[model samples]
Target: MSVWDELVGQEPVVQTLQRAVEDAASMTHAWLFTGPPGSGRSNAALSFAAALQCEEGGCGHCRSCTTARAGSHPDITVIRTDGLSIGTDVAREYVRKAALRPALGRRQVLVVEDADRLTDQAANALLKAVEEPSAYTVWMLCAPAMEDVIVTIRSRCRPVLLRTPSAEAIAGLLVERDGVEPELAGAMAAASQGHIGRARGLARDPQARERRRRILALPAGLGTLGDCLAAAQSIHEEAGERSAAIADAADERELDDLKQSWGVEERGRRPTGYAGSLSSLEKDQKRRRTRLTRDAIDGVLLDLLSFCRDVVVAQQAPRAALVNADVAESVRSAAGVWTVESTVARIDAIVEARESLTANAAPLLVLERMMMEFLPR
Candidate 1:
């Protein structure tokens, strides 16, 4: 299948990019792709990159198309970062690479997956490259929103906006691509609230689904102060556990690779730059751990916000469909105790918590404050 197939419910975006690929004058040196989380911003950028490199404008079968889609093309560099922020060093390296002529493909494609994560220095470094790119170079930057990117850099690039796919579209993709049962896919789609990656995770992993269920059930149990505190603690601990698991795996892999590269079985022999490499890796891991922890906390807050939103919806339109339909009874119970204003306040609290997390506030403290807001007066 063509690379565009993976972009669910983005037909307009696909058409625009396809036309650009076919017409040299329509294509620009720099592109900024903006969308909400799971709206396929990165996927759209990658697809466009593939099309630009493909002999037949993303004929899926071509070597250039396949390699670009797989992120192994000689001329396509896809930066999928796991760190909290993209540093100036990384941006400079990408810029250096972008200045080179195409090795194999028709154009040198540079796709930065999380442009929103770029620090000011990094953004400035990237801006210089985009401002004066080589004739055969193409830059594609992905961010959650236009505001996340600096105005000077964003204004120089062509903008492509992607919308969150509908639940029906998400469910259809799950059923078609993942072989998921229709009923389960539909439920996961509804629960994901338009997040494509989250829907796939909920559909594929029972543990993820159970965790979401527990998170959704938390609001119904927040009758007492103790219950609210306990809920906060549970979410905090879960985020810690998830972050730890990811960090552990990454640490092991990095150490293993270092050991192999140095030809040292144990800790005896040390190659040149070994200590520096290890130190740099550890520092990066620490940053990544922090980002992962905040991401987990933000995910819980999103789930909680959805639950509160469902309560508000239930109160306003009793027959309206709920995001957490499986927990309809708990949602209805919450709706009984919370008025529209109170529910909206609870949602505001959750949003505040999300912002605090983004600002690097302590996750536990932010969560605790948020949970207390949910406690019944």
Candidate 2:
């Protein structure tokens, strides 16, 4: 029932954080938490923050625990990014607030999720606060890895690295915590490659399961160059659709909220500054959509690469657990026809796709080129 219990399959991380909480020596003015997506980096930060703030060192049912978990704690402030990057204005605000006194809790804890998304000015703004530590302030920054944060900032913070959880651990968590069926939970956990968020999505959403199944089945259908091209196109189109769906959902909610605030309907809009707000909102939406597309394509590429890796491992190292165990027959066949070198090339293709996306290349164009490279001669 501890707050740390919410972090799935991360026993080592939990133990480390708990020990840090118990002993005052681990308490630092700044901490850097790094892990893969869905690895609970921010969650760990918050739970640890809760433990630090709690009078009894993370008594799970205490008021501090509830407040920290719900993100309404008086002294715990979490900055989350909904846009492409965090600007200096926002960072300055947080820094200014951080400089102030604590309202309720003993230590004023600040958690910044997506520290990698902080713009240069924003990073500098926050760096000042990091450099000058307050006696009663604690800062925890979460990112994909230490490399994502500026070396100056990273150097000032204690590092906490979280490894990807094992599939067996994830499945056990789903069964024990989520009351999921053991068999279905195991499959979802394996397919998700220990990404807790993805495993939960696959467990709860039938559509997500279908999409994963489609991705995993790609190897069996790659008989001809045309098949490869088609598969590539399928991956590209599906990624686009999924990304757009996410953007649309958020965009719609934002628009609805704006309309309500302005008291304007679609057919009747007569506010003084409505048009300007609408323009700004659309611009923000566009950036978010672009980021979402790239993120979705990146995820698709990862899934594709995992399948290839699983196939490679199956052929050369059958004892290893396969990421796509449910589709083992196709993985075996694909590995059977391809050499380790060819499998390595396919993995390279995935790396290229990831590079293109990270470099701001067009998703469709990059995926199309990758597909060409992945096609068999």
| Candidate 1 clash pair list | none
Candidate 1 wrongly placed segments (more than 4 Å): 256-278
CA shift of 362, model 2, Å:
1.3
For candidate 1, the TM-score is: 0.92
Candidate 1 displacement at residue 153 in angstroms: 2.0
Per-residue accuracy of model 2 over 11-72 as CA lDDT, tens digit each: 77888888888887866789999988888898899999999889888888999989888889
Candidate 2 residue-pair clash tally: 0
Candidate 1 lDDT score at position 261? 82
Q: What overall lDDT goes with each candidate model? A: 0.89, 0.85
Which stretches of candidate 2 lie above 4 Å from their native place?
Answer: 8-12, 223-229, 252-280
lDDT of 1 at 195: 88
For residue 249, what is the lDDT in candidate 2? 91
TM-score of each: 0.92, 0.89
